[model samples]
Target: MGKEQEKEVILEQMEERAVEEISTHDAEKSIEEKLVAVQEEIAGYQDKMLRAAAEFDNYKKRMERDRNAAMKYAGEHILREILPVVDNLERALNQGVVSGVDAEMKLAALLEGVQLTLKSLLAVLEKFEVKAIESVGLPFDPNIQEALVMEPSDVVPASHVLGEFEKGYYYKDRLLRVAKVIVSSGKAAS
Candidate 1:
C-alpha cells in the first residue's frame, strides 16, 4: 500500500523475530540444565548400585570362609575324646606283655581294662547324644530295628523283639544305625 506503512510493518516483524529468538535461546538453556541434572542423578544411582553389588560379593566371600572353617574342624571334639580311649587300649596291651605276669592274671587285667575303656567310650557317646535303642522285650520297630531272624519264643509275644544281634543307635534325634534283632513268632502250637 503506502511506503510508510510498509516500513512500519517490516520493523514490527524484525522485533517479533528478535523476541522469538531470545525466548527460544532461554528455553534451550533451561533444557540443557535439566538434562545435565538428570545425568548427574543417573550417575549417583549407578554408584550406589555398584557399592551394593560389591557389598554382596564381600558377604558371600565371608560366609564361604566361615563354612570352610567349620568343615575343617567339624569332628575335632569327637577325635579328642577318642584319643583318650586309644591311650587306654595301648596301656592295656602293654600291661599284657609285662614280664613275669601270669597268663590268667594278665588276661583278667586286660579284660577289665577293656571293660573300663568301653564304659568310658559309652559315656562319651552319651554326652554327644548318641544313644542305644532298646530292642529286647520291646515291640519290633522297622524304623529303628532290623529283623535278622524270626524265632519262636515262649517269653516274647509275636511281633516282639526277643534278642538283639547288634545294637541300634541314635545320634542326637537322628537314626545312626538300625538294631539287628530277632523277632518272636510266638510260642509253638500245642
Candidate 2:
C-alpha cells in the first residue's frame, strides 16, 4: 500500500476506536446511575418497613397494658357495692348502744337494721346475677343439695328435700354453694 493510503486507513481506525470508547464510557455511566437509583429506592422501602414494624410493636404493648389494667381492677365494682353493707352494720352497732334506748327496743332496731342490710346485700348480689336456690319441697338433687339427715315426712315424698340447714346459692347459672339439706325417706314406719 502507499504511505498516504496507509495513513488515511490508520486515521479512520483511530476515529472508530475513539467513538467506541466514548460509547462504552457512556453506557457504564448510565448503568451506574440506574444502580444508584435502584439502591436509593430500596433504602426508602426499607425505612418504611422498619417504621411500620416498630409501630405495630408499640400497638401490641399498649393493648397488653390495657388488658392488664382491666384485669387488675376487675373486682373494683363488686367491692364498692359491698362497702355500704359494712357501713350499715357499723351504724346498726353504734345505734344498739345508745344511752336513751331500752334493751328490747335496741334489739329490735338492730334486728331490723340487719334485715335491711341483708336485703340490700341480696339486691346487690342479684344485680350481679347471684340467686338463691329453692330446695324445700323440691326434689332432692345431689348436684345442688348435700343431704345432712334423712327424715321421715308424710308431707314430703321420698327422695325430696325436707329442709335446708344452709340454703344453696347460684351465681350466673352455676351452683355457687350446695344446700345442706334434710332429705325425706318416705312416710314414718307403721
- Predicted model with the maximum TM-score: 2
lDDT of all predictions, in order shown?
Answer: 0.94, 0.95
Cα shift from native, residue 170, model 2 (Å): 2.7
Candidate 2 per-residue lDDT over residues 108-189, each given as its tens digit: 9999989889988998999999999999999999999999999999999999999989999999989999999999999999
Clashing pairs in 2: none
Prediction 2 TM-score vs. true: 0.81
Q: Show where candidate 2 strays beyond 4 Å.
A: 1-27
For model 1, name the residue pairs that clash: none
Cα-based RMSD of candidate 2: 2.8
Q: Could you tell me how far off, in angstroms, the CA of residue 119 lies in candidate 1 after the best superposition?
A: 1.8
- Model 1, 109: alpha-carbon shift in Å? 2.3
